[model samples]
Target: MSRTTATIDPAELKAAGTARQTDSSAPNADRPRRRFNWGKVFAWAVMIALLIITVFPFYWMLRTSLTSNSALYANDMSLLPTDFDLGGFARVFGLQSPEEAIAQGGSGASIDFWRYLLNSVVVATAITVCQVFFSAMAAYAFSRLHWRGRDFVFSLFLLSLMVPLIYTLLPNFLLIRDLGLIDTLLGIMLPSLFMTPFAIFFLRQFFMNVPTEIEEAALIDGAGKIRIFFRLIIPMTVGPITTVAILTYMNAWNDYLWPLMVSYTDDSRVLTVALGNFTEQTPQTGPDWAGLMAATLVAALPMLLLFLFFARRIVNSIGFSGIK
Candidate 1:
């Protein structure tokens, strides 16, 4: 028996390995590399610049709030806080003595921050809840239920939106006065408590997109209209409902003109009116820039937190589709 032995060349093996590597990378080598996308880069740059511009004011406000009023004028242009002090917060809360406040360029008389904040909360909350609820009900009726003159009535509502808010203020004020609700929180909330035309329209659009089959199923199961609304429709449409509530709350919370017209005393004064009055009473020296900034931050904190908490919900709701 004879055995044959084969000897392989190292150069040939090396060449074969190199060929395999080349073959493996041939597709990638043939493919074109992506070029630098100047448009995308430019877009990102613009967005970053806009973000800085938008955020800088709030940062300045916070910096001023932390700065000392006496040194504020000197360091007005400084981007950072100067002579860090808590006296601004103290003045806002009435913790500083009149002499100290006056020395710090403050008004000496502290505004009732807590009381006005409470009044704002009450008014905003009442208006938001009531307006959203009534708006949803009205939207359902307009979108889901067919009735005589439904489109006509809805068009009338849309028309109301065109009317200037200022145009109706005098009439609203007179009505509130006649009801003897002037200088009351109820009066401040009454105008917006029912439903805004915008709110009704917004909800109606979403309601119309709801699937009829699901609603029909519920009806077959003997679910009444009210039951279906509260149990099924509301649950399914939580995203839009939350959006409506947030918008309504923001409008009510930021409403200054109506509250100013109705509320005269401390009992019904909202934060906006109180802030206006606070600035008006500035001393001969100047406005208490630090204290005023601090108060403004407090006034804006609620809305900031609200947006932060429900930001995802808002994003989701904006592109919501009712189809499963």
Candidate 2:
């Protein structure tokens, strides 16, 4: 019945609107935030389980290495060694003489532990260095230098990757035998020293990713290809090179079949081969499980340390290559 219009304050209406908005939003602001995500929790659980699964064998090996033979052969399995015994390691290192080992009821066979360890180190290092250097050179030629039939030749290298390594073993063995490199560490390294298809392919991928402008600039300044490669390319791709080095080193160190085929004596035997021989026992006693585990732990230490140190670089290199 208010035929007469009433004036409302605009400020008052705005104030009421603001008050309603604040009141409505207050509960949402004060409410607790979600702190748990089931998906994330499930992922974390799976990751932890996988980590335990991967690491448990190494832990068990270490535990066995520290435990006494009697404890290892006991009816109940102990996750942790009850008594810390170094006798397994002692026997492995030949710190305990055969007589002492026999008296202590341990494996009495004498193994040249240090000699085999040295052999592994020398051969692995040699293979890594030679392979990396030669692979880089080949990669440079493939990626940077233009020549006839380049793609065709590279196709051959790529094709080699598809061939199983075991298939080449006989021919390689025959060649090594003809060369009188049988039972020689040099023979063990010869097959890998020149260049590997995988190594060349891996380095070539990285090399191609390198900025061509940098090489062009160097060339304009009268720098030779060799100089550019050694000075520029190498410094820029250390990550990939290190990754290749680590891979090559690991392959050489862990190689068993080839080394076993060529090496008969301890002089030429690598750690893996020596470790196999270490477990061999006469008809009287059984295999030395504890001592064998100790030697295995020792043998695996260098590779583990290498991975621990270079794992980040290796991952980064792989990621970088994928991006390119």
Best model per TM-score: 2
Per-residue lDDT for 180-289 in model 2, tens only? 99999999999989998888988998889899899999999999988988999999999788888888899999999999999988889999998776545631555566
Once superposed on the true structure, which residue ranges of model 1 sit more than 4 Å away at CA?
A: 1-45, 315-324
The C-alpha lDDT values of all candidates are: 0.84, 0.83
Strongest candidate by lDDT: 1
Candidate 1 lDDT by residue in tens digits, 1-324: 264223334465456456555756776542222122233345557977999999998998899999998889884677778799988888888888899989998887757889999999999999999999999999999988879999899889989978999999999999999999999999999988889987787788888888999999999999999898898788888878889899889889898889999999999999999987875688899889999999999899999999899988766765542332
Clashes of 2: 0
Model 2 ranges off by over 4 Å:
1-43, 317-324
Poorest 10 consecutive residues by lDDT, candidate 2:
30-39
Candidate 1: minimum summed lDDT over ten consecutive residues — where? 30-39
Per-prediction TM-score: 0.83, 0.84
